[model samples]
Target chain A: MEMFVHDETPTAAVDQREQVVSALAGSVRDLVDATIRSTVADEELLAVRAGVDALVARLRTEQRPGPAGVRYNSEGRSWSWGNAVVGHGNAIAPPLAIDHDTERGRSRAEVVLGAAYEGPPGMVHGGVSALLLDQIMGETASGFKRLTMTGTLTLRYRRPLPLGPVALECWIASEAGRKVTVEASIGNADGVAVEATGLFLVPRWAPLAADEQPEGWRRSAEG
Target chain B: MEMFVHDETPTAAVDQREQVVSALAGSVRDLVDATIRSTVADEELLAVRAGVDALVARLRTEQRPGPAGVRYNSEGRSWSWGNAVVGHGNAIAPPLAIDHDTERGRSRAEVVLGAAYEGPPGMVHGGVSALLLDQIMGETASGFKRLTMTGTLTLRYRRPLPLGPVALECWIASEAGRKVTVEASIGNADGVAVEATGLFLVPRWAPLAADEQPEGWRRSAEG
Candidate 1:
């Protein structure tokens, strides 16, 4: 994966960072799928885990202490590499790259599930589907510029989702003070497998002003 | 841990089967916890994996030909061993045993989470907390005499919850034709850790009449 360290580039450096982050995310997604489908032997698995642990330790030696909160540049670009939904470095994320259509208040992403996400035989784990829906719905509720937390989310699994390429879509249904409602779905080429509705809340404790919100809120909602 | 099967008395016979199912579920939960916390040598882990695979094969020797759908009895007892939220035989569940107070429209449960439920260091996984809340809220919405599915749920993690015993409480706030609203919370001996609100829906496809409602819905919602 490509790596970069903060330097003296102008805040306009956002575009370059976005590109690098996207490429890394794609690689991480591929890595996850490989890890799942690999027919590697036990000894090989142990060796890989050990290598990964060493790499983690090496990164820890140079990292800031604490979770990677969201960060943004003056040019209005933000990134969150530790995000459970869309983090570039999180192998567990299914690494979805969601695209938002601002005018339509909608978003969509495509992803593939492999062994790591399987539950029933070849079917994707139900919880994994819920996690993806949660993120997309949260993004839809926030509309890329506000703060929202999953207040409530409901999902229905009409059929088992096989482990393979799938698509996800989400859009805002309604909004109220401190509350936004979102609708989302996940499906394969055949048809929709799961449907979801969410009630996302900007917690009473959270700031409501657009400019005063934390960067984490912005990145999660927008990206 | 308790066996209670008898073929003579109808209720006793049913209870006996439930006991066996419960024991299997307990074993599964134990297996999950063991897998998470095991620090066994690589060779031992491989051996364990082989043993587990063998056991799975043996169990499949006489298994049903289809998914374990929800089941109920004429006497109004119900069991869903494969339910994601409260399945008696699911290793992934904390296996919550919820108690309802129909008169008060409230429900409560106690459970202990171990290594398998960890997210942050020494803390219960956030998703686990959400899972527990969903089940309880769904029950509250149903009032133990109807059927309801989660439509939306909102949670706030006021603080990190340590992995150990926790108490959960839920109560209905209001209801409409297809919607039931619920309020819930989770805490330990010290105090509350998280609070939740949820909206549950009885799918438009589901029946509304008390007499026509499925027995499983009646027991889960009313019990």
Candidate 2:
């Protein structure tokens, strides 16, 4: 029954702030990857931990009362820096930008799987593949015009997804009264590595639009 | 064809190191969550950003040759600190500890979904739900005795799962040839919140145990 609705007036300042924070989050994300791969001495690593903790304390001095709930301006420009899939402020989330063509009911995305996403020997984590596919499929189902939740997801890792540039494609496969099925895949230049099919639910509380919605669905800048 | 094999001797030092590193990674993960929740002033945020970036630069001075490929010690003790689902070195990964009852052919996990994992309004991200299920299911399928990859995942979000302490359970439903079916669900103090069924594939290259094998599968100390 509870969901985020960013149907508000546009705020240029908010957008600008997101960009600023996202850029910083990006750096912090890089830091995370680096720290994981670092071979620094135990002494130095321990010393750096002190400084990192200090920075955290400073940043925590003034904090949001709770989680950074999803927000949007009047223009429907929504931002959820805390989202696990596309949260700009979250380093744990893969920095993914999904582009959807609502008219065609298709979507495409590109991202570089880094060291932080490895699972096997040099391959992208299988769980990460599912995470990305679920997000894309949910977005394709919702498109911002309507709210949709993931109902079921099916994934097939046909081959190893190297830790580097990867592409993902998704589309609405079928739809019924309250159930929407989405198909998606992630791959590299060679070919598809992981394929996915998902079923999304349109909560009874939030019904589908009776008429075709305007293209404002692209405001998932926060999704 | 390359995969992580822990069919060797186990090392006590490695386990000790993991415990130490995981403790540090836990602090860093806290820093990440704190940063996202911070509402510091623009001036303070900017100043802190510089300091954070500097620390990152220092850490990046020396890096792993590449992604920290999965490593298994001589004692067959395997440690994969880069896995997105259960890597101890990864701050972005949910600090999940999956426990499997090989005798019962079931698995159980408990974790606190923090701000980084939110998708809907205060609910755990649907994709995160899928991620966790896939990992637990895969582990259930493998039981850490053999290799398994998620072939397909089906999930149903019965309702919202509020942020905070959550529990998950998984078990093998059926198996035929190379396919293993796993059923799982995540919930809080309440009943089930999200239910999942996954089909895991045991590739021909990595077949099941052919004979009585050593009990090297310690159920993932940090799973």
Best by lDDT: 2
Residue A15 displacement (Å), model 1: 33
> Chain A only: TM-score of every candidate?
0.80, 0.90
Summarize candidate 1's per-residue lDDT along A100-125 as a digit string, tens digits. 99679899999976544543334555
**Best model number under DockQ:** 2
Residues A59-167 of candidate 2: C-alpha lDDT, one tens digit per residue: 8998876676676555656677888888888777777888889888899999998888876667887778878887888888886667777766777778778889999
Model 1 share of native interface contacts: 0.02
Winning model by TM-score: 2
